[model samples]
Target: MVQLSNNSALIFDGLALESYVSGKRSFMRTPSVSLLLPSPEGTRRAFLIMRNVTAINPLCLPAKAWQQNVAAAVRPAQLPGVQSHSGCHNQTGTCVDDSNAPVWQRCWKQVCQNIDVACSGARLNSAGNPAPTYYDINLLDVALFCPVVLDQACLDSLGPLGCTLLYESGAGPGMLPAAPLAVALGDATGSQGGGHGSATPLVVGVIVGGVVLLVVAVGVVVLLVRRRRPQAQTAKTGGAPFHEGLDSLGTRSTTSAAGTVGLSMLPTESTARAFPTMGSAGSGATGSGHAAPSTWPLPDANKRAHSQGSDTTVITNQTPIGDCEFDVKIEMPPQDGVAGACVGGSAQPDVQLTGIVLGRGAFGRVYQGIYNGQAVAVKLLTELTVDSADQACEAMMQELEVLGRCNHPNVVKVLAASSLDAARPALVLELMETSLDKVLYAKPGHLLSLQLVLHIALETAKGLAYLHPTVLHRDLKPANVLLRDPGSDKPVVKLSDFGLSRIRHSVLKTMHPEAGTPAYMAPECFDLTAGGLTHRTDCYSFGVLLWEMLAGAQPWYGMTAVQIAYEVTLLSRRLPLRPKNTPGGQVLERWPHRLSALLSGCFERDPQRRPAAADIVKALALAQQDLDNLSRRATPTRTAVE
Candidate 1:
């Protein structure tokens, strides 16, 4: 216990502050404590303790249990063994301890404000359940240790507190002590999501900080670092906290708290949500065209992902892509060999194969692998789809030629290609987490909002526009559109699987009549006799995708592929638009008339009359603008909080 004078303070044995002093900023893994402001009864407070405190996996917690735990975490309680702060002047009413130090009080107030917003958002789901969430601890860490670790500017960001904590008292830069820091740099030791094998999985829990900070110590910026005896860890299940920084301070450690921290939390595969994580934000997609992923301030899913409020029907798969309402997609046959060089001059050797197959197809398989230090998708050709080795080699060459030329952020990229004579002919490609179809059908609470729909549409259209006038993605259905959320709730869409695409083709009768998915194909696809295939063929498919997204269901929920071809091509029928929402998951009140009109243009009977991909991109951009205006009008401007 410390003094309760004009600047009353609580003290810990001094935890992780030592590591920051030792220059292990990147490895500061510690349990984070965030105070939730209680109802304004003169500085009452409660805090949520994170970093593997609960025994059961938070993902598996029942709705009731989850709520109880959260209630417990946020319940107001006095600091243990400490009385009211007579010196505490909490005019703002966010402080918990009595500290006259401006920096100390100011830091807690700012933290309380942010926690106020996040706790409200993360506390409940649409069904009013307590959804598990990972609140960022970095924000708090920066405030408390700014002077001790961060530069002058970093310390300055916290306003007057900066000078008061660092220079004003001449106590010098200081902070509370923490657990020993530790670091283990290596690849994730292969634990696929949702695996329930008997083998004990050494799951690396997200290490916000592998520490328990208890006190709001006051004095000099830092009390001289006291080496507290190692605290025993509470029981944990399935996974253990990953320790960050080097374990230079202690010999006592948990079985698994021996590795990295300061990383993003891994989602349990049981939830079926594979959004982009700061760590391994999807294997491919790491080319120069894409920006490095960053950590985002994620709010509650219910705040952004609203219920679809669309048709809830069961769709049974007929063929690969169901159309008798068969909505399942079937793989298209590979084309004959291309004459150009598949490997050109920059041929890459076999990828560092993890042997983890991501997907399998008729001509080959996609593997989760690493290439030159980056996670990548390795698409390899095999003899299963072809009669001979030569045929397999030719198929790989053809697929590579089509994708190798594409270099755009919105298109799946080809990083490297193998030679036709290599031991394993493969294509090293950027990997995204899930297909657009998955995003559209994401759990009711994580479905698409209009802003996201338009975003996916604009990005997809841009990819198409880049390919047009030269290539035709004969199949442009939702299944071909890949998505990666990259920390932001909005998923980034990129076109993939150009297996059915044709490049630099002529009106000369094509070789494969059944080249595209029947549901997404243009009428001319049914009868090349009707008209020649062009980029317009892809527009029709894109329009169908837009309908699927709005409807939040398959385009032809109950129709067969043969029937779809007949109805769409001959009768000129289209599925109705599904309902859509805004960023906050509320019904987009501005409703997209422009989007309806664009769909009409795309579905024009005459290919010549259909809007081009570039035209579609422009129209989608307008819808985005409409969303911005609607948001501004709906939300009242307020002075900034804290």
Candidate 2:
């Protein structure tokens, strides 16, 4: 006989059971019966009545009979409590001497009861003291101890109710089940009535209702988890930022700094993320260690384009439009003495100035502005020095000329120009999030994967390729490479800042003073008399940029611009390659031999030996293919982090 609160008693007869309340008549006698009694804390406790007990003492009951009774009463499949072990509990009502049972089963009774009762005199310790027994067990411990029983298939088959109960009672592989179980437990404990005279049937009904509600809630959670599994797996395996709606073809829409809209189709985010890191950002070609890739923005549809020479190839699904009124204005004579000139209308007065400076350079200051309610970057020429007014004007016009003629996707565009007041000339250009130089320096530890580096190399080369035969970006460095933040898509890189750029034909005859960053200047650039500056000059700067991307350190550290110029011009010194065992070299070690050879070719001292921009694109494509193949052959690894 067991006594419950509210003066209730469960009496076991030899063949039947009776539930009686003090000061009230006996309710009923039945072969098998159960009662759900409400506690002061508003939690329900389940009590089972054992009928036809041959032995009055609970401990004297046969082990097999006890197991059968407990199993039938608890019904773990339906209630998610203990599976019933005769050895788990003895006559004293203490959970003890359950060494033969699995650890999970030994602790299941306490887990289901949500209690922390201590066992006394269960076993002896080496110190001759009573060894304490804890009924609490963690879910991770259960999964680790009994992986086969709690495998994915078994967990799924448990259904929401059983699974929630088991999970709440400490079962599963991760902490994911803890939250839902907590909610279920809290709700179950909060829904009970405090009245003492409530009917047994009403109390049971409430408990059942709470269980059903908890099951539904857990089922909903299970569905949501199943839905996010694919995305979570992709993020874990890919190791790159996830993007939504990215399709197999890797196509996306982008807008340029010039407001020119275009479409770009590149590799998917997973493919890009899997690319290995080649070097640290901003590290010079000779740096000893490599830095992880930072978040480099990929070009969007408006800023990316594919073209073969003069023919625009629409690889992505987009419509092409004719030239707009905002065409760039070229003051200089056309290349090869061509008669046609590209001109654009004056800037609209409606353009609003925000006065927020985005960046500053020797030539001018770039400010974040708004035009037609769209964000833009406005480059204003610096105030002329006492004797440099004419020179500054000429530089501004040269920039306008080069930018105006450029319609390629990778090149920055000029939206409009205002020279009506020559003293305050300004160029309204498309705004970019930041420059490659800033990206490298800002995120020193974020190593870029090889695939993304190759992509940048290819895009930069494409811009240069388009500029060749018509224009030359005399100053090509990481600083000039502008990036657009695509939010969810990969970042887009565009070549900007053409203050020193020159038309190809004019460069062949002109022997002007040095006009670009000395560190990026090719050997020929130091002595214009050796051979006129050509498109190849840009190649040399590109090679240096490549080295910077791989080395992730400053070029010629501890040397000034003058020293760098002298070293390349007089000493005939070039950027050094990484030795085999260095940290930076380790990054390069993963590269395919073809890629290494390509880098070597790009850095060749002989201008003629260096590959053209188009050739560089082809080489990068091949390297990217190698990376894709490697990713395909790789097996997925399980990660604990999201």
Best by lDDT: 2
Query: For model 1, how does the per-residue alpha-carbon lDDT over 333-362 read when each residue is reduced to its tens digit?
Result: 223543223222334323555657777876
In terms of lDDT, model 2 sits at: 0.44
lDDT score for candidate 1 against the true structure: 0.42
Tell me the alpha-carbon RMSD of every candidate: 28.5, 33.7
> Which ranges in model 1 have alpha carbons more than 4 Å from their true place?
1-349, 383-395, 422-424, 444-446, 486-490, 505-509, 578-591, 639-642
Instruction: For each candidate, give its TM-score against the true structure.
Output: 0.43, 0.45
Look at candidate 2 and tell me the lDDT of residue 273: 8
lDDT of 2 by residue, 1-642 (tens): 111222111222221111111111111101111122222222122222222221111011123322232333212121234432213232234432222222233222112111111111011235422221111111110111111122333224443223323433323322111111001001112331111110111111112312223353344334434423333445432212222232343322121111111112222121110111111122221223322122212223244432333422211101121121232232212356564232233343534556577888665678777766788887776655767766776676667656655667787877776642354567778888888888767765554556667778888988887777336678899999998872322578899988776643112323352668877878767763332445667888887887777666666767887888789878878876763332355575445687667767766655667887778878878877888788866845455332
